[model samples]
Target chain A: MKLFFGEIYDDHAILNEEESHHFAKVLRGQEGDVVHVTDGKGKLAKVEINSISKKVVEGSIIELKTDFEKKNYYLHVAIAPTKTMERLEFFLEKATEIGIDEITFLQTFHSERKNIKIERIEKIIQAATKQSLKAYLPKVNDLTKFNDFIKQDFENFTKCIAHCEDDIVKTPLKSILENEPNKILILIGPEGDFSRDEILNAEKENYKGISLGQQRFRTETAALQAVFAIDWELKS
Target chain B: MKLFFGEIYDDHAILNEEESHHFAKVLRGQEGDVVHVTDGKGKLAKVEINSISKKVVEGSIIELKTDFEKKNYYLHVAIAPTKTMERLEFFLEKATEIGIDEITFLQTFHSERKNIKIERIEKIIQAATKQSLKAYLPKVNDLTKFNDFIKQDFENFTKCIAHCEDDIVKTPLKSILENEPNKILILIGPEGDFSRDEILNAEKENYKGISLGQQRFRTETAALQAVFAIDWELKS
Candidate 1:
């Protein structure tokens, strides 16, 4: 099913500008034609086009569904951006395809890349979401400082930090979610890994230190590995 | 520890041309400098630099180790190449980081890509191996016809195929490997997926049909999913 990103309202929906152009100009869509639309917020609809233009495709919602293909669990992956933006972007695209609820770029002690182009990241996520035919879009937040991020409240979430410190005995992520908690938050470290203080601070906040197996992975690879692991845990 | 890709011998080792340039010119190595080298065939060594040049870095193996950090299981993922080359390259890099033994490209009935640049792919695998400090590199084979690929001898391997056909009651990949089969070969379909006739042919060959999950993934994503699943199975 080809899903176009757009906004869904009570009785009608509007395709986003880029999607509108594709529907109107690329696909040569016409009035009265039915198309599948998703608002990337668990809302999907089959709309009949009432008007079509290059940058505006207005349609009346012939059928609307709320909580469309809802996810049973929520996964939030907070990762430190890689030294190279391409790797992080690739991770975002694949994670979206694999299924992610939310993402955050953590500015850690050893994070090399400080600033990221959120607009570009968003476009990549949207493309992957449409390509994978997933209705819900993964939410992305601004880069948050590690200290500030840990200060936030995560009362009900199963918070886990994936670190490579050899001194601590870490449990595998797969084993931690045996009972299948609905809300999961995973923290992935940077290339040099989180500082000793960062790990201790997280532990002080009651964050469980988890492991992503023995072999070491790059910053982006670790994040995606965690994301894929969560999906495997929930799906299986 | 930073790992460099090279060929290890009984008493000495030689870095590949690209790696030699990196070590001699980029890193400015001198005589007596010790470095770690992996032959990508389960051989690793600590070498003391005896000679250094732009394209030739020869060293004496001070400490050689075979089967260094060896994996417990062997995973072979055969997937159809994606239409876009970038997607396939990204998958190769990530799969190497996640740990894979071998890979093959299948020219299926609906294959979008018929040929690939092996030199480029080899370079990617080498870089990922070095970056991940892996002693063994994932062997990549040339594109082969689907029928020819399925006809190959896979007697000792637990062979499985992943497909999205609704009619087939597919077993989850995780479930099939519960017994911890050491050698595993998984087949992933193209963007258009495997043709019905192709699926039937594989089934006739005693290939167990498998599913990655309910969600649909692109050609490259599906292949990486299978790779990750195998790694997860072995490491956990």
Candidate 2:
């Protein structure tokens, strides 16, 4: 099935700029071509191309479905960006492919996404979503400071902070899966890990320190591990 | 501590040609510099560089450690290579970081690694092993035909074949972890997936059909997913 990201409306849908160009030029799409479109909000529309132009491809929605391939849980990962943007982009791509609901860049003491280009990052996530045939696109937020971000109320989610600090008692993620928590939000720190005070502050807010495994994964790998942990445990 | 991949012996270690070049040139190593070298076969040596040259950096083994951070389980993944070599390299790098023991490229009817350069593939895995501070370097096998590959004895390991064939009553990987099998061998097909006869032959050899998850993962993603499933389950 040919799937593209687009905006869905009452009875018609228009492919996004890139998708429109791809359909019109790259794929040489024309009228009467049938394709699937996703709104990136858990809605899938089967459409028949009615109007095709160089800049816009509009289609009549033959069928619309909501909650397409919806998982039973929500995963929000707030991770400290890597020194290299490629590593963080890898995390975004894999997390989107594996299934994640939201992602936030944590501006920690050691690392920050200072030069992050949000548009390019969004494109990477969108590509992964389309490649993985996902209807719901994972949300990507701006670079948020650690202190300011931790103050948000996560009263209903399993809030975890993965750090490399040895003194702190860390719990394994599998232990938390014992109760099968549906809503999970994990904060993976930079290579230097969350500052002593940063971890302490999160601890005061009920965020548990979690260890991914024995191996020392890179910052991106740590974040993806958290994503796989939930999606793997809950699904199976 | 700087860790590198090399050959270890009784009282001395010699960095591989590339790593020796990296040490002598990239990192600018001199005599008396302390570093750690791994044989990539479960031995690590604390070496003090006593002899240094352009292409050979030999060091005296100050201390040696065997089975350093050795994982409890062994993972052997026989996967059909992807069309793009980058995807297969990505799998090799990630699998090495997460603790895979052996990897074999299955020359399946759908996809084959005809142009796969084994040396470059080994380099990627070696870099990952060093980056992750792992002692045991994963063994990379030559591309083997699917029929010839399945005939090899896998009597003790929990052998699984992940395919897109829905006719087979597939078991989730998580289900197989109930008994916590220490050794696991999973066959991940190419993007087109394994043929009916290929899967049936594996089944004839007691290879249970397993599903990684619900997502339509790419060939590389499926292989990495299997690696994570075992590493994640066994670790925690």
Candidate 1 has an lDDT of 0.87
lDDT of 1 by residue, B1-236 (tens): 56888898889999989889988788887888898998889999999989987688999999988998888888899989899999899999999988889999899999978899988999999888887778898999988899999999987899898998889768888788788989988898988899988888998888889998877788888888888877887764
Residue A190: error of model 2 in Å? 1.4
- lDDT at B155, model 1: 77
Candidate 1 error regions (>4 Å): A53-55, B16-22, B53-56
Q: What C-alpha lDDT values do all the predictions have?
A: 0.87, 0.88
lDDT of 1 by residue, A173-205 (tens): 878878798898989999999998999999888
What are the per-model C-alpha RMSD values against the true structure? 2.0, 2.0
Quote fnat for model 2: 0.70
Q: State TM-scores per candidate.
A: 0.94, 0.94
lDDT of 2 by residue, B1-236 (tens): 88988899999999999889999999988999999999888899999999988889999999999998888888899988899887787778878888799999889988845657888888888788888888998989988999998999987998999987988889988889877998889999987899999999999988999988887798988888888888887864
True contacts kept of each: 0.75, 0.70
Candidate closest to the true structure, highest DockQ: 1
**Candidate 2 local lDDT, residue A162:** 89
